[model samples]
Target: MGFADTIPARLGNLSFRISLDMSNNSFHGYLPKEMSHLRQLKLDLSRNLLIGQILSALSNCSRLESLDLSYNQFSGYIPKQGIGNLTMLKKLYHIYLTWNNFSGAILASISNCSKLAAISLGHNKFSGQIPNSIISLCHNKFSGQISNSIGNLRCLAVIDLSANNLTSEFSSSELGLFTSPNRLHIFKNCGLKGNIPDSIGNLSNLVILGLGDNSWTGSIPTTIAEINLSSSFLRGPLAPEMGELKDLESLDLSNNQFSGKILSSIWRLESLDHLSLANNSLQESISDNL
Candidate 1:
């Protein structure tokens, strides 16, 4: 398309650029090689039709701190050669490559960016186990267990491995070490199986936890509340310990094999807005103590 032929030549003439945001446009075709001309601190080209490989020429932007190419049609193995150069700058921190057509194993070269804090590659076609260096990963075709190596990311704060094909146990001891105050962990619609680890309670700062539509078999952890586990194959008595979440807002445990009396504790969540316990084998009886 003419887009591939014309835009870069025009963009190159602009000077003194600190950031460039050209997102949410219809700009299609390959990223122009002349993109390297602008030494922007950040570049956002998300939610567009940009396609083909990411240009290695972008590595020339030595001062670049963030590069977001999400929600696009960009495909092929992530331009590791291009990205490898960018990481060497030690300044790039956030790299968002979500909702693209990119595939293949995540490159180990990403680890070279030791200063990296957030790397969101969700909703891609990438296969294979997640790299140990990753702190934030999600929504790909990744299989196998959630690696215990993720515990190594001391600065880790968020993980959203939802809607993938992962099947295995979570590393309780490793995941328990996360101490971020605003942590959000989601692992819904995957093939994960095993007990909801007690160690999950350690994440006191958790605001959102999604574990729905999996094969997990266990009683809901009392330490967990305001969460979603609908359609997951969980079975066991719903623990009365759920009343501890005075701040609980939403709870969904429908379409499971849970067999027990609905605890009065659940009826007491003052912050509860949405509650679902449908399609379960629970005994129907209500405490009049409301």
Candidate 2:
């Protein structure tokens, strides 16, 4: 039998992961609804001129784990059926739907993927408050404030939630995860204010803590013996207790109201790398046992 320009209907009989990839071949029209019968399958029809709404009938693949329908002239929202039978496939991970015109906030449906390690819904028109449960270390504004329970993810390594429309107070307690090896960067303009919490000292394993460009005021927490709090609007006198952080390599308290003599406790840091107390009104009198 010679190869024909059209997809052979007989190709469906493979009964196992049959990839009929004729995408972008100028194949105009609806996909054969019978294509859903393929068992143990992965379907890819992206980068095509295929036009029409995604079919909801493809939910028949009880064993289907992955699907790709990106980069096409397709219009309207994404098909939700491809995710209907995820109970059986324990190995399912990774789903990308980039360069499409999908819309709506699906906080309820995608939560079923409780075991997902990484998820991306970028380049689409998704909005509203991102669910607090589905996101532990990182999240964006689907709506609402940052979840108070976001501090539960103990295994999270890297977090990035810099750009969004959120409002709340970021406390040193939220940086509790720094006790582990993971680093954190929170550049929120979310009206965060008040004194620095002493809980940050618990992060013995933290490498970097980024809390710049916020409205935090008051005394620096003594627990944060090591960190850079420049341009954070951090005011008040430096507490002598902060020098207890022996692990601190650098301290940046420039442009703050830190006044009074330096605490005797600050001299305890054997691992201190740099200490910046510049541009502050302090009654500091440095002396040594000469």
Candidate 3:
């Protein structure tokens, strides 16, 4: 059997608690209201069988800095009182709520956590545009245009919205907004169109970029390499700048409308171990250089 509803009442007396990790257990029933009395710093109740709405009274845990309630049977919208109202959460750094049945819009109030660095609400039924305060938003059923406000997250390092309904083209300035070192951006199958902005090269620490199965047009940006634009509508000649990615190991541009000759400079990518240009309009000529 899972933990009983009376469990919280037993643990409530320890008001000086800083961390409670009851993850991957059979703890069931609603989260207890008695949790509000403790000044916790971290709470992890993931991978459990717990259900019911997150109690608004939890806002009283003023020293909380990390919360992970992922992989559970929790239902209902996130507390309307807003987790942002917890002033102590201003120091919160991570929030994970993946693989749940939670619904409703991601509140703009989440930005109140000025020190927030990572947030994952993916694999949920969340709707509405991503808030500007978010550093990384991914894999939710979110809709609406990805606003340029995303650029405001100077501390952002990764963003993967791989299976959503976000649309719109990024202008040069918009693409250049991301300055995080070692960033990975994925937007596969998201109905995105328009050419990839050349400003993509501006991401000095980018390692992986996936934009496949979209309606993007235009030539592959010369400044970009080590990317996957396969199964899209990208056309035009391969750019010589393909040689720029010294660390590029894999490049996939197959099933597109690329024409003309392949860039010979691509062969010089020392780190490149896998390359694909299949099903394109390129004229074949035997090349003695392998």
**Candidates sorted on lDDT, descending:** 1, 3, 2
Give lDDT tens digits, candidate 3, residues 1-290.
44633246667777877788888777778877887776666889888888888878777776778889898877778774646464545667778888888888887777666677777787888788777665345667777777676666666666777778888776677776665564666667577888777777777667778889888876555444468989888888887677676788889999998988877777888988889999999875747547
Give the backbone clash total of model 1.
0
lDDT of 2 by residue, 31-140 (tens): 56666566666666656555565556555655555566556544555456644234433334434454555565544455445454333444555557654333222233
* Cα distance off (Å), candidate 3, residue 190: 1.1
Residue 243 displacement (Å), model 2: 1.3
Give, for candidate 1, the lowest lDDT window spanning 10 residues. 1-10
Off by over 4 Å in 2: 1-111, 118-126, 133-143, 152-154, 170-190, 218-226, 254-257, 260-270, 274-290
In model 3, pairs of residues that clash are none
Tell me the deviation in Å of residue 95 in model 3.
0.4
Kindly report which residue stretches of model 1 are placed more than 4 angstroms away from their true locations once superposed.
1-6, 13-15, 84-86, 133-138, 180-182, 223-225, 287-290
Those runs of model 3 whose alpha carbons end farther than 4 Å from true positions after fitting are 1-8, 84-88, 180-182, 219-225, 285-290
Give per-residue CA lDDT, model 1, range 12-38, as digits (tens).
555467788888777777877777777
My TM-score estimates for the predictions, one after another, are 0.88, 0.53, 0.88
Model 2, residue 174: C-alpha shift (Å): 7.5
What is candidate 1's TM-score against the reference? Answer: 0.88
